[model samples]
Target: MKKLLLFLLTCLLAIHLAFPQPPAIRYQVAEPRLADSLDISHYAKKRGLRAGAMVFGLNMGVWTFDRFILKGDYAYINMHTIKENIKHGFVWDNDAFETNMFMHPYHGNLYYNSARSNGYNYWQSGLFALGGSLMWEVFMENEHPSANDVIATPIGGMALGEVTYRVSDLILDDRKGGWSRFGLEFAAFVVSPMRGLTRIINGDAWKRRSTSGKQFGVPNVSVDISMGIRTLELKDEILDQGMGIATEIKVAYGDRFDTEETKPYDYFSINANLNFQASQPVLGQLNIIGRLSARNLVDKPKHYLSLGLYQHFDYYDSDTISVSSAKTPYKFCTPASFGGGFIYQYKGLKNWDINAFAHLNAILLGGSLSDYYKVDKRIYNLASGYSTKMGADFIFKKEVFAISARYDVYHMFTWKGYSGEIDWRKIEPKTLNAQGDRSRAILHAVGLRADIRLRNRLYLTGTFMNYTRNTKYRYFSDVFSNSSEGRLMLTYKF
Candidate 1:
């Protein structure tokens, strides 16, 4: 649930940037007063305070957006890796292999083990993430964080926040707090629902209680399912013709060891995809494609599958520890989803003129990676994600004339923790015991490309991106605010 909330929140952040109404273009009247003394200590202290305040303010703003906009979002995405993808060198390979990830955040296996602990709730911590995210927006104003964005964000988030808090209180007292406040505020930025009205969905207090929401994975069962259709191939005519169908599913469950030392959130997942296509289509110029997927659904969600699993570590620390302090990944487990759709298109413009698809995916993957452990997995559908921008695509030049963008603001719906007990490693080899676990990090990508003729069948492309980040037990869900760069590739064929 936390993961779903985070993903939806991130999507909202992007939407907030491009709201329907243009913001009042306000120019900075004057620079805010900075510590002039330049005394190193005073300067540092001043900066720290400013940072904290900005963080708080920004968080407040985003949360407000949730209340006003999306109302609340329910995340539905697959976060798992198939053994075949790994064997085929398609998995996200960092430093570790054959590891029990998600144990740290999902089950608290790496951090607390057995000592039951407790701390801040979702609202309090959300305040922290929002504060920081907003601060960055401010800094980006006129400069890196943007002051205009900060102001607008707060206005939007606050209006939504007030309504959400009052509503939560009016109907259910137990569900009111920083988490729901944060959830409602953030949800708005993603979906407007209506001009002024708000949509309230997924108020799962009962589910929260049943799952014991936190960072540790203790939920008894987790059922994740995804089924849809699309076209990998296309026909020259209509979009529904000569297409394909596809589906994928996964599930997991575990308990026993409340923390890493004694036991861990033990579980497994099954993922499968099926596709079928026709040989030819309209004008005998295209082909048909189809896909199907099936996954077993369980009645409950595992601790790792619930919202509280990832933040479980916060319960044991003074403030909060890093997701990997204990060396557990706490990701890589998922439920099942199997379904597929179709599409059709034509060719021969520039590189090829075409039209195609249905029920596509706008998939995004994430987690963490560091020197201590790697987490790039458990990123619901951690593999290369391809979203439904399943429309007609027309390439004007060679493949190099690639122009692709997705504007799905109107359609579709979207999409941890630990224990402390004992270290089974002491008595047996690692794999045999589920007592303690960890997940580990980074990729560098740079690509530059040039188009070549069919005979050469060569292209030049370059892309550069690599980053390492640590998610604290209480870190904000919208942390794409912290990003770095790294890698490169180019090719020429003749």
Candidate 2:
């Protein structure tokens, strides 16, 4: 229940960003005579109606699929079950997997589009996502509704939805014609299908408009493609090494200090990475952060403090030899967390930028597969932790070369007293020999990154990261592991 309240409060903050303000144009003007210059009130009613229709259509589609193709009893949702579930209150459900991590966010994306295409702001669109999630929980399924779904769907959805929306916006070209315009529009559609649907519905898909005079501020975007080698070493074990390929994309929205009206997610950064090792996918990570508040501390704003909310996702799955057996077993771990943090930035030194941040996060939920005593199996843990990071970036020779270094520490704790134990086989009462056993882990990482500009919009980049983890169990021996990776890549900036 506490978790539910925390999520609810966070969502409220999101909605606050969407509260109605005095009639003013919020979008940056790219051109003086653009169609968007028309009075917002002129189409307010029509947009509202369209939004409603979209909500209804989405619900209908989900219901039809659930009842017909899936042959589920969602159409006959049990009101009694829902009531009972509500009475029981919220919980950290362990049965959820792909639905919580992927599908719920996708649904939220659809809801966001329903609101955004109708001219709602980013934060306002999140409210629509929440409404849609509530509807599904209350009336769309026969089984009792899940608390996890309600939280993950809206928040995670909004994060991913906004990113998709922005990327689509970057791809769209309204001024072009012929195959070039069609390709651009098609690419945008691939990024945001709901937006495409709404455009077709409104006849905007077939219309051509001059966008040459538009002057919107463009965000900074970069993509990195690297080939790397990674090695993992367990205490006293031989190094396990493999060649890997990694791709990373980062986008930094316009500077926050440049404007007074700091809209939600106006100063945001997004990063996504995928890595494959030895012909198999091994790791993936996604990070999104949006500044919520900021204040200048120096005369020329050389020093500042900012607060932000962040979402983090990490997944690693690999095959390794089990300590207790000769068989190679699969090891996997996935952690997704959301929280807010504070950042301090200093630019007092010429050509240098220094940043430090501390974050407190709720694990929300996570899972792992661990092997004990030759038994290759899966185990799970729920933990909350905090992290601290500090980094410095140095620019040299008129920004022709840049060097950066960072260090981070993370700590997590989990206590299980039989009540939270899912599979007792791995964590037997006798093995623990006591109640209220606690487990803790800490990870330390250091990274170095460098970029060499080869041209105005292209660069050569290199990065190296070293990571170490230490775990302690109340009644078991401590486990220690470490890994290192190095990458060389080409980066393009836009």
Candidate 3:
């Protein structure tokens, strides 16, 4: 996990250093290539085979490291163990929250990109992730397969994978040559290695040609990178803990108001944050909202409204903080979620803009901190439920000032748990006795932000957010907790 975070930080820093200023904007429209087309029948079997090989290679490499260097017992697998695992079926494995929630999804991203970069589209690449996860669970590891992993890997992989793929596309340009092209390719490789590898194999890394245009149709994108200091307070206290150096990268891909055509991820927004503090993970939060489809209801000179189906991926993890009499460990995520919503934009006097959205999402599978149940190092519960989210932005449109506010509410229910009388210590690791801490948790969050443009592409931003969790347990008293954070940042937009 530390290594993964470090790699991510290094990549982001390299991008920042490479492009001190935004590149010249170019608009290109070209006919879609057969490889990039939506038709699923035009699959490349060779690329698919290569993707499969890569998945097998990754599984073997990890197993080798774990078996030899780490000497981990779980890495030791045999035909008999594989047979046992197949017979045992799916169970909720007790692994660290970060390992299951963060690392597995990342691994799945690699699997997804293996196919995505190899002439496969969004929907087709997802199959590689699913296949890769199944290979690892049934053939690579000795432990029984996990229910949460199968869901998280492919679904979360699609979200993160597509984001990286688009970001890489935004970086690569075959028209440029020499150091300029080399630098761009290197940065894109850092973001998506599988794509880089495929490019190398196909001799496109250094081969400069007249611009054939982007594989995915060119979409206008806006990027903001921010650096700042943030302080997290437990309950309602101020400055109770040390501050952390916070950095964030926000990307808005494609124009949401463009109602001419709608695709799976044509309009998506991503928010990724990193915190350098003692008590927090290097990755603080990663949120993705991608529009799957849309229909224009009202289109006018002053007002535009559209209804759309969206895909949501949210992940938040923090260390346990004592708040009053409660132990609040801020760990909640919805790796697989689908929702429908409406997007309304009002262009008032002097080009002023007001944007608002409301969404109701069904959480297929999610994780939240548990009150009592603990197995191995796992203290989070796996559950299914729903959420309601709404947000609005008041942009002065003068590029000078903007204010935004958002509210989110989640309701989750855990269906698999053991009684308090059961001897958890004697439960077999391979058995599906206790899935997680059985409880119902409701999480509510409110956030506000203000941004002032300090320069042409620079802004000073201030943000505050408060989170509250209420967990009701079957065998224990209810737990209620609160946490809040405030941040001041300097943001550069591209």
> Which window of ten consecutive residues has the lowest lDDT sum in model 2?
16-25
lDDT of 1 by residue, 14-88 (tens): 211110110111112123222223221221222233334434443455445654575533111112222322233
Q: Considering every candidate listed, which one attains the maximal lDDT?
A: 3
Q: How many pairs of residues collide in each model?
A: 164, 3, 0
Clashing residue pairs in candidate 2, if any? 30-214, 30-215, 31-214
Q: What is the TM-score of each predicted model, taking all chains together?
A: 0.22, 0.71, 0.87
lDDT: worst 10-residue window of model 1: 311-320
Best by TM-score: 3
RMSD of 2: 11.2
How does model 1 score by TM-score? 0.22
lDDT of 3: 0.75
- Ranking of candidates on lDDT, top first: 3, 2, 1
